[model samples]
Target: MLRPILFIFVLFFFKYTYGQNEIYELRVYEMEFFKPANILHDYFEKALIPALNREGVNNVGAFEESGETLPKKIYLLISYQNMQAHQDVTDALKNDTQFKLDAQTYWETPSEKTPFKRIESIFIRSVSGFPNLDKPADDSEFFELRIYESHNEDALRRKVKMFNDSEFAIFNDVGLNTVFFGENISGNQMPCLTYLLAFKNKEEHEKAWSKFGPHPEWQRIVKLEEYKNAMNDISRIFLKPLTYSQL
Candidate 1:
């Protein structure tokens, strides 16, 4: 009888732990044309990513903007099981011997001569509707990172509710392949939410979005009074995965 009770407790603990929402750190490296990004790429491909994997983080995505633009930027997505897990990884990296050795080159570089001018990190937490980052099964060539900024906290809450209550289902029906959805807990834009979508190509992206606006369910819910003014601004960026990117 004691053994059975212990087994039940273990089972319950496993379910609760695995069902918890995730935390994500989106790091953006802003680079100037004068500096080459090879060192930065090398550190990620050779040192940082591998170190994170050893520490039990998986599916780390490294990407660059799809088109050439001034001040080129690289995007890195790192997911943690939870806030505590994220803190643990951070503390562990400091004492990771192999990680230090591999990152020696980057560490030795002069600040003024480094590959990137600055780094911006955005912290996010998974929403109820999307509790984990979903790696695409298909070979996705194009990616979209979108952010919706709300006018206030209440508006942001409503927008998140719309996603949980209806928008996510509509996205599935319209063929919008989502990678993740989270609310920004700490970042440049307050009261904002961010999400990523993957597609086979630009044509597929256009096709999928074309279906979303006219979908009957979307048309109906979008007009609901509760959701009005839920978002005041939207920002989007197109990205392509680097050769070593896991996502």
Candidate 2:
């Protein structure tokens, strides 16, 4: 009730506090493996990594989703606190001789077609008030956050059934505010599944978890032998809006 009002108030207050500059960070999704993921990984390590720093790019790292659990097993996180600052690299790319050469070898290789095979990018704006809302689901959570790094196609279908059971069971039994849940979609380098929680704000995210954790129903679910190993590695990150985000 009060949260929506607060979000609006904060949006306006924070908007002008920085003098109309809105910040956003792009979560670049590099989907599909480049024939040989190892080679592409090496290219990023050798070329893209140093180039980003030399070009004054902010934060860059890759999160490998557990291929054993999901078909989509890669997640890469790139950060930019200010959008206008983007020109620093684009400008450098125009003038940097060494960077240009590295770029050509890394990206424009004759045999290498392209880094991204198919891209499903999503622009996520921070919910001003919820800071750590990105964490995995709690007992009282109306939603479920399950990520999978699959090894084969058959397991993907199995993973889907497991997810539906978990999320649906939570909602039906717990009376929690489970509204929406979906995989984080993108043109990703490593394929993995990601789910977001829709809480009122940061406070409720905490409250829901604390209550959910000890609930008898939740404890029972957690102890189910069938659900013993659902995720390989579940990592969550928060993105602050860069100065360039339109919303």
Tell me, by TM-score, which candidate is best.
1
- Judged by lDDT against the true structure, how good is candidate 2? 0.45
What tens digits encode model 2's per-residue C-alpha lDDT throughout 11-46?
A: 897764543322323344455543545545565566
Each prediction's TM-score against the native?
Answer: 0.94, 0.41
lDDT of 2 at 226: 59
Model 1 regions lying over 4 Å from their true place: 1-16
Model 1: how far is 209 from its true place, Å? 0.3
Weakest 10 consecutive residues of candidate 1 by summed lDDT: 13-22
Looking at candidate 2, the ten consecutive residues that score lowest on lDDT are 238-247
Cα shift from native, residue 177, model 2 (Å): 22
lDDT of 1 by residue, 88-200 (tens): 99999999999999999999989877989889999999999988999975589899999999999999999999999999999999889999899999999998999999999
Record all residue pairs in model 1 with backbone atoms less than 3 Å apart, i.e. clashing. none
| lDDT (Cα atoms) of all candidates against the true structure | 0.93, 0.45
Which parts of model 2 are misplaced by more than 4 Å?
Answer: 1-34, 69-73, 111-116, 130-247
